[model samples]
Target: MGVKITGIGSYIPSEIAKNEHFGKHHFYNEDGTRFGHENDVIIEKFKAITGISERRYLPKTLVTSDIASFAAENALKNASLNKEELDYIIVAHNYGDVNYDSVQSDTVPSIATRVKHNLKIEKPTCVAYDVLFGCPGWIEGMIQANAFIKSGIAKKCLVIGAESLSRVVDPHDRDSMIYSDGAGAAIVEKSSEEGGILSHYSATFAFEEAHFIYFGESNNLELKDTRRYIKMYGRKIYEFALSNVPDAMKTCLDQSGISVDEVKMIFIHQANEKMDEAIVNRFYKLYDRTPPKDSMPMSIDKLGNSSVATIPTLYDLVLNNELKGYSVKENDVVIFASVGAGMNINAIVYRI
Candidate 1:
């Protein structure tokens, strides 16, 4: 009784937004004060900190569910599984389908339902729903699929993490440069193979950190509109992750009975380069060693942070040999971890 990802796929947006794209834009502090430094200085500092040179943006004609379906279709094809055989379709996203013309997010029928409809999966028994646990949504979906398979309630499930962060970001906010648009999905099913998902851990720290990331008015006070966009206290979130994420990953790995040395890779959320590096370093420190070189494969340099989509997308690229200089072999152990809004943190110890 093992739950394993049989196939994986991702849809990286075709629209490339280089850092220079934001050079002409005005950036203001959270209190509406103008920056003393020029845009070039700000951009360089942002790149140095986030390791993001460029990011992808969804085109005007597409929405969140649209890219989700594309990734779902690719996963189904990669798995060679029939649509009708799927027992579940779970979509992990923060903002739903957002049109370029509207400031509102539409999730009337649920993104999973829309994805199923787009895929033409007519199986009424194929339960479809959405999860909004911040950036950890994708890994959480995978954990749910594992439970379903282990409980004998499902044989095959499609777990997708997709986001159009570009659609929800405030252009006036410098943090907007940390977001991108993309989709990634995996086909999880019961397998006779040896190793699969071994252990997982999740926690929410909402007591004092509930609003660490939220929807808020633009940093530019000149815009007198009542609209809100994705916003966060970058410093607070960074500190929160540094203090908690590493411990969560260690707990998950300890439960999996896999020693630190056995971990071949760690697919952490692409929130920030420095934050992720610190988290991983701390996780390795728990075992009294440093992270092995190439132990973490990152796509944030080009993709930015797609929230829930980051880990699955990075894993899909590596598994397909599409990510340069990174590859995974059979029997290799890996860890998937994430921290995001909801002040949530989660990790999954997996074996390939």
Candidate 2:
């Protein structure tokens, strides 16, 4: 028997921010030049390199819970389960609804209340909490949910990975141009089956290679400064992901008694196109097998790296015929791998 993912859903804010919109930033050079301004060059240089055609963002009036509520409701409906049956709710977010000023505030409780009210769910015994990590958050949440159920501590779990990254984006920085806002949710239930979450491997290298992905002042007064936005060492991160994730993937498959050659598909955190290609190429070299010619899937192009939400959102897109002809079925081993800003990497195998 194994824990199974019954349903999955994703929510992108209605507001769409495009790459061309960055043209309005007044940091251009005398020759009408700006770093990463050329569309094609920018696309080719970055890992997830497609110009983010459009991305969703929560309006000023909305918060993280609102985005989460939408995703959770859709996930529950897709799973054909009632919200009342949810034994636990796990929210994975690096940025919360309230700004840093309200870190001491009861933001978790308030967000929980709003989720319950919006979804019309009965108060759950385990109603509140947040998990802070880098991009590997959603995969970590799933691993935790599976553990909770396997321990008989929960019957069903709603695992949500949501982020309103626009709040942390430095409008003037070209690196931030690819970031947008979104949320994703999954409904997991315990089943006496052979598939579900087969194995998970996670590791964090806390070395100070290039640690600053997102930063804010320890004092509230620094909120107004542009430094408060996310800053990424793109080259270092790309190198880290390329070198680390392939080993992590091999470790997961090795522990699961499955060879990488046997797996049918791989779903990586949709960080960028170039990164995706690099990882996929590595897989090809390591296994000496081609990836079924179109099996590598990505959503970073349009979704603009929805952080933790990227994987699940890409999963939904695949399941909903967005990726036509690529079908996931029983006994097929699918791998989920991610590397987040904390120099953290998570790789898991799931059989469906």
Candidate 3:
């Protein structure tokens, strides 16, 4: 039996944070100097380059698990399956439920565990756990679910990517503006029909250039001992992803023994519009062709960089025919690819 995504769902917070929501104090220049009101140029450049006009943030009452549970329920409902039917629940997140403080104060009852509880599942056979593979966590979960179904270890799995990013962002940090809160999920089950997940490849190059996105103090150039927030090297990450991600996708397609022209859609991580556009262009250029318009659908314009949630959420939109001029149909081939924080890169080929 092949593993196939039977259903998909996503949840974005109601609170919309716009680019102008942040002021001068929230940014700093390359030299660690303050980026005062004169930083409007930076905001303009970010929106122009990343295509992100706004993003979501959870209300004080909502946590990562709440968003996860909502999306999970929608996925299960879309599949016309009950919670009891789930053989596995795999949640992918970089940090657990972050409160308003943005600090991970708890981990025992994992985000997956919390989601399980929130779902109110009573079946003990429905095991649940979490994966921490940077932005590729959900893809890794899907790969693992494919293995499980192929090996007869599971009949159905609920794979989810959820995060409360606002909790981890430093208000004074411009990079934080690109982060958002949301969740996405899919129901992967065994299928007797052909055209499911076809090929997979993953690699880590941390030793080459590590700690691109890390947690550290909130102060200027100095790395303080205490405050905890997400910090990123934007230019370095952009360069790294450009150099490696496309090759990884091409390698995956090559291994699948399929022509790049056969790809109907590509659900890439909604990290940055310009970077993603560059990656897709280069991927097609390898075969001396150009990417078809609308071949790659994006959600970053509405949701910013939601890390692991990007692919699943985008897939959900496509599956539901919510993306204009972009939809998935049978016999179509789709490629999923991502590169993020760990300097980790992975890609999967799926046939519908």
**Maximum-lDDT candidate:** 1
lDDT of 1 by residue, 1-352 (tens): 6789998999999999999999999998889998789999999999999999999998999999999999999999999999999999999999999999688999999999999999998889999999999999999999999999999999999999999998888888999999999999999999998799999999999999999999999989999988789999999999999999999999999999998999999999999999999999999998999999899999999999999999989999999888888899989999999999999999999998
Residue clash pairs of candidate 1: none
**TM value for model 3:** 0.95
Over 96-147, each residue of candidate 3 has an lDDT whose tens digit, in order, gives 8777754454567998999999999999989999998889889999999999
lDDT (Cα, tens digit) per residue for candidate 2, span 75-102 = 9989999788898888877767745233
RMSD (CA, Å), candidate 2 to true, equals 4.2
Quote each prediction's TM-score. Answer: 0.99, 0.87, 0.95
Residue pairs whose backbone atoms clash in candidate 3: 26-172, 102-167, 331-352
Ranking by lDDT: 1, 3, 2
Specify the poorest-scoring 10-residue window by lDDT in model 2: 216-225
Estimate the overall C-alpha local distance difference test score of candidate 2. Answer: 0.76
What is the TM-score of candidate 1?
Answer: 0.99
Alpha carbon deviation, residue 99, candidate 2 (Å) = 7.8
Model 2 spans with C-alpha error above 4 angstroms: 27-51, 98-114, 209-212, 216-227
